[model samples]
Target: MAEIVALFLALCVQLLALPVYVLSFLGLWDPFCKKVFFPFFMEKTMVNYNQKMLRHKQDLFRNMMDFADPSGKLSVLELGTGTGTNFQFFPPNCRITCTDPNPHFKERLAKSMAKNKHLEYGNFITTPGEDLSQIPDASVDVVVCTLVLCSVKNVEAVLREICRVLKPGGAFYFLEHVAAERSSWSFFWQQVYRPTWALVFDGCSLTRAIWADIEKASFSEIKLKHIHAPFPWTPIQAHIVGYAVK
Candidate 1:
């Protein structure tokens, strides 16, 4: 009974939080997301919730680093750079242009990355992942989005912009948690939890079929790798990791 009550409360909290965060994302509240999910919040809860999720995140990072070019001269761009934790993996010679609509992140990343300012040779625009109109075409060599796809309002528009900015043969490396492939258990939990999950996590959805979405867009050479056996959001056996090239 206690466990059931706890679960119900969790769902309720997520429901209460969702609409507020969504409005913030629509730019009605500006950077409230960072305050809601930054530092300890994301470390504990999912932008979309997952149990056994953290272990897989480390593994996903490993895979992403391995996929990157060794020359370190690749021009890269990342969307939804929440805490800038991925900054450590960028090669010293790599010049990555990162953007996010969160003002808290804009300031924190600038402060945290002050020492390595020289590595970023290009412009870091203040833009959301869904709109890259501010950035010119054919400017990026690698596009990365780690655990961010779930929150974007328009996945197709962002992907279209990604294809446009990526130089021919450039790579798109991503690690995201998505709907599980096949599991009655996975299906049941995801379906049961999705509503409250997206609410508390600021529009992050576990049921999104990201691979299909990416492939449907104008890109070639899509590669996907499933992590472990279940889902990336939970380690009890839930993790998915994938990378694709354009």
Candidate 2:
């Protein structure tokens, strides 16, 4: 029965992805994905997943924000700030700058900001995570990335940029779904579905061991833990949430 459900979900994903593939050929995939498809899909489907992960997010944010500035004011930069889902988790009065490769997220991001009025908005920059040249070195007090590394073209380059933009002793917080254990059935299916998953989800790979790249990044101190997220999809249930200091 579990396998049957997985298969059905995969079929649904494929059906939904067909239009995205067609749009890709016309160079409209990015706008459609960021502005319409993903926001709508995630809002509709991710309610349970977001609720289950709320406590973890709260704990991680509390720790990072506390360490970032004792006074509770922080200059924060979020990579791939899709729909500004993390805005509510930020500390009060935090000045947040957001970045996403797709310029189409501006409208949704503004809506999210409107709901979370405690935090100050610091402009959204349209850029990929691999290159943050516009942000000066060692400037931001906190850098946050959640559910982003799996899709980046170069995980190593993104990590380098994260470190570059972080101030000395700044905190870098991340929460990402990763590949499951090698011997697990989920891992086997993850390998099988990776290509289709990436294509459908705008490059989100199902089998990337993202924690390994975070470990290799140039951070002075690192701490992370691997756990199974409560995602209904078995292949992406494996996740890691932690913070590194630069």
Candidate 3:
């Protein structure tokens, strides 16, 4: 069965990561897995999904860019900016500050920056989303996060940091996979595979009700919708995409 195959693949991935687990005590596991192993894994498995969603992602970025002031260059702070995948979608002349907990992504991030020459690089901050202490309060015009909340240690804390860093009336744009409807078949599978999925994918929870936390985060205005993304990975097909005003 397909489920059996999926589980088998997950187990295989865990086995491959066994050496990294052993290196956890030496503080090398997280960096190595995130910067090297995970990117390689995603590139192999997510090509089709990313291709399918390309148009949708483009439209979402266009909409988010509408919030930018036409007369001035935009300032953007991106959380969990893995490989700077969203850089191509940003409007020209925008200054982008990228933040990720794993510092080892610098090499890949630099490569992406080189490719997206339209956008200006503000610098990379090696800090988690929950604690953005290096960025001054109300410093950025827009904050962006994509496929990131599921792995964060505390979503609420990250949301608070987002609100604090954005200027008044600034926007928070996000695209995230979340829990499916409670009674759906996808939800059932999500629950069944969650433990293995989290272990293999660096603690990304397949069943997080992230929209609920966003609602409680008290954004001035929120425009969000749920849709099933065309993901080969069934448990994470349910997704949400939208922007909020701070």
Candidate 4:
């Protein structure tokens, strides 16, 4: 009977943990994820991952000079600037306004901006990428987006907003993980894994045809290059880095 009681206790414990698993899987545990888990995970895992891909990031940012103000008056709008991880990549003296849907990340993003000491912080608006009504059209000199396209509900709407905010000849710099070519084994596996993967990663789709979407957007000049980045051996490592000029 003692053994039976122990087994019952173990089962109860497992049952208690089920909700967390379910919430995590459904990407609805945003508070716990953004406040606790992502802070720790991003600092440890993604920071290192991004460090490995700094060259690609640098290549994308190099075009900033082509569109930015020389007198330190450049205005930048960054979509989905969670935790401000990409703050270090921006050119010095840039006036940067950042936005993300999650309010939990605002504090951490503030702290990151405090530490960076390079760019001037403009505002931290808690809004989704699909809507940017707070920002005026053709007002920003550059818009930066990195690793954000995969999770937004409407990719095209977000793309339109990015295009709308930029000044004439303004640059849109992005680094995104894209769907692998349809013919490859990588593409096959990405399709198989995407459902559960999106569940675990807060609705991030591993198979988003982001490159094609960017290509189809209304940009006067668009140049993108496919480059493999170091992410744990997975089809998600297929990345696109470059800029589109509006």
Top-TM-score candidate index: 2
lDDT of 1: 0.65
Model 4 Cα lDDT, one tens digit per residue, 25-60: 687676677667666665566678668988887777
Q: What lDDT score goes with residue 13 in model 2?
A: 64
Candidate 4 residue spans exceeding 4 A from truth: 1-21, 24-31, 70-72
Candidate 3, which segments miss by more than 4 Å at Cα? Answer: 1-32, 43-47
Candidate 3: C-alpha RMSD after superposition? 3.9
lDDT of 1 by residue, 187-237 (tens): 456665676666555677877778778879777787767554443444123
Off by over 4 Å in 2: 1-31, 69-72
Query: How well does candidate 1 score on lDDT at residue 106?
Result: 59
What ordering of candidates by lDDT runs from best to worst? 2, 3, 4, 1
Identify the superior model by lDDT, candidate 1 or candidate 4. Answer: 4
TM-score, one value per model? 0.71, 0.87, 0.86, 0.86
Ranked by lDDT, the better of candidates 1 and 3 is 3
The candidate, 1 or 2, that scores higher on lDDT is: 2
- lDDT at 42, model 1: 52
- Put down candidate 3 lDDT per residue, 1-246, tens digits, no spaces: 656765776667657767655677578866777878887775455446567778777877786555566667789999998778788789886899999887776877788899999999988998999999999998888999999999999999999999999988899999999999887778767866776567657789998999999999959999898988987657888999988999
